[model samples]
Target: MTTPRTEHLVLPGVLTAEQAAETVAGIRAVQREDGAIPWFRGHHLDPWDHTEAAMALDAAGEHQAAAQAYAWLARHQNEDGSWYAAYHDGDFRRPTDLSRESNFCAYVAVGVWHHYLATGDDAFLDRMWPVVFAAIEFALRLQQPGGQIGWKREADGTPVADALLTGSSSVHHALRCALAIAAEREEPQPDWELAAGALAHAIHRHPERFLDKDRYSMDWYYPVLGGAITGAAATARIERRWEEFVVPGLGVRCVLPNPWVTGGESCELALTLWAMGESDRALEILQSIAHLRAPGGMYWTGYVFEAVGDSRRAVWPEEQTTWTAGSLLLAVAALGGDEATTAVFGGDRLPQGLPPECCTR
Candidate 1:
């Protein structure tokens, strides 16, 4: 039976009342005592994925747990308002990857704003405002003249000038969320508004500014998913490469010319479709990936559909990740009309920063 809290998480062919609870529990179980949500118990945690899982908890009515996750970010944030790309799960103080990614750092705003919307906690928003502000600033400092953000900074703090389509798209979404937070607090950040406009313009009209990662499914849909491309453009973009990245019942392929389908990409694509007002297609996509669901309500990272020599088609990598489950729950939440999830992904209620004069001119 679905409780009132998880009732909105129930989706036909996606999650049942009990199953939704289990999935929520599955993510929560992966969250350590200090609020760090690693991929799994022994795996590493990245800021973006950790934030995604935290947002899933919010969608499941686990507000306190979600807040804790945000608190963890606040506690561990680097002096420059960024986080290392990957942290060892067993010891939060130990960073396995020292690079700081723009998208990864910027994502705190999305999760913070989502948590605020889900809980209506003014104090939480107030407390997280600085964290979001600093993180966005760190990312925007690397924004190129073309408006696409540089992908990351090396361990030695050298900025990588190259931008990635998927990463910039994600950063674009985060900037809007950060702007929304500013709007809520009556703190108008004109610079952020202009930066957002430039970023969106780059993502929508200046793809050349970004590296060609088109072979990855994320590059195909992230611009749309990230709200930088929408309306007819979003629909056409999805349709243009639908067959190339989507593999029907198995889920979305991680990359082209590969027999691999990943649960994270499939769920994100479903979320993208839902955001495009194609709920029926979104539901179908979600339902199609049911085969990736593992026991205990977690989902395997991906499956390799094609057999290689003596190896049969199997769940490749053989790891069920918290972020994979989180992505699924978020997609189901959007399809099920969870207001917080809808507001975040729906892109209508969120503020659109002023259009850049460069793009307009």
Candidate 2:
């Protein structure tokens, strides 16, 4: 239950084995009775963050708990194969009226596949097949004319914005995971493969069709980390935006002209660096962000937009976030050469929820 024990869940050089284990224990403390993982006990839970927390649980060898987390998602899924973007923390909680985010809906496949890979339990995958199938079906309803996935859908199923590059890139990874699960079960998924390959191609060749949000670092590097881009192309993209967003040793800014450095985006950038084979630099990035950690295993959402003369005092207070810890685990997992993350969420393979272009080279 201590930090040191949690550190052993990952390989050396990522966290002081002690630090990694401590973070894992922090996540363990947040699981609800229903197996849903809130950011913190009594805090609201969202599907995307919940899935990341479950993956952290699996990484910590809490297999049964991780499985229960997915079961919660399955039981709560809406009729159209999606879940609401948010949930209230209290009892008798209904959907919070937020639209079902396509990317969040798609993420379950990757989480399910990761659990299966970690545990090698075919029965678990079998149990999850229907849920995974339904989620992918719901996500696909938002795919626009160009193979880009629309960003979100209302409760009644109306589409929202044009496909977001970041969300679709994440979906591209999810689609590949779903296909892998299908392959493991010897299930036929020709359409799934076709959809994945096409989505990857769309991400590769057509970046303009997506909403322009280069303001966020996730939009800049996630495609590369998620395997939607590679070689000199990926490096070039990082280079083009590095000066605009990165703030040296602290972390990455959520947007330009903002002095804030967020642990989540910093860790994600580190993972993307590892995906590009720059593991050493990725390690440095992870190490630099360690300073952001607070008393518990939590991290501030970001540094303040304004800093004092010493740059030590934050002008505005920040929220301590679970996803910040999740992002660090994902980064550490990538740096330590964790095959599961690379295989499930990395490499050139498209994940489960993407459209046809995902698998195309």
- Best candidate (score: lDDT): 1
Clashes of each: 0, 37
Which runs in model 1 stand beyond 4 Å of their true positions?
none
In order, what lDDT does every prediction score?
Answer: 0.92, 0.77
RMSD of each: 1.1, 3.3
Task: Estimate candidate 2's alpha-carbon lDDT, on a 0 to 1 scale.
Answer: 0.77
lDDT of 1 by residue, 1-361 (tens): 6798899888889889998899999998888999999999989999999999999999999999999999999998999999999999825678999999999999999999899999999999999999999999999999999888999999999999999999998998999999999999999999998888888888888888988889999999999999989888888989999999999888899998889999999999999999999999989889988998888999999899998788899998899898999999999999888998999999998878778765451
Worst 10 residues of 2 by lDDT: 350-359
Name the TM-score of candidate 1.
Answer: 0.98
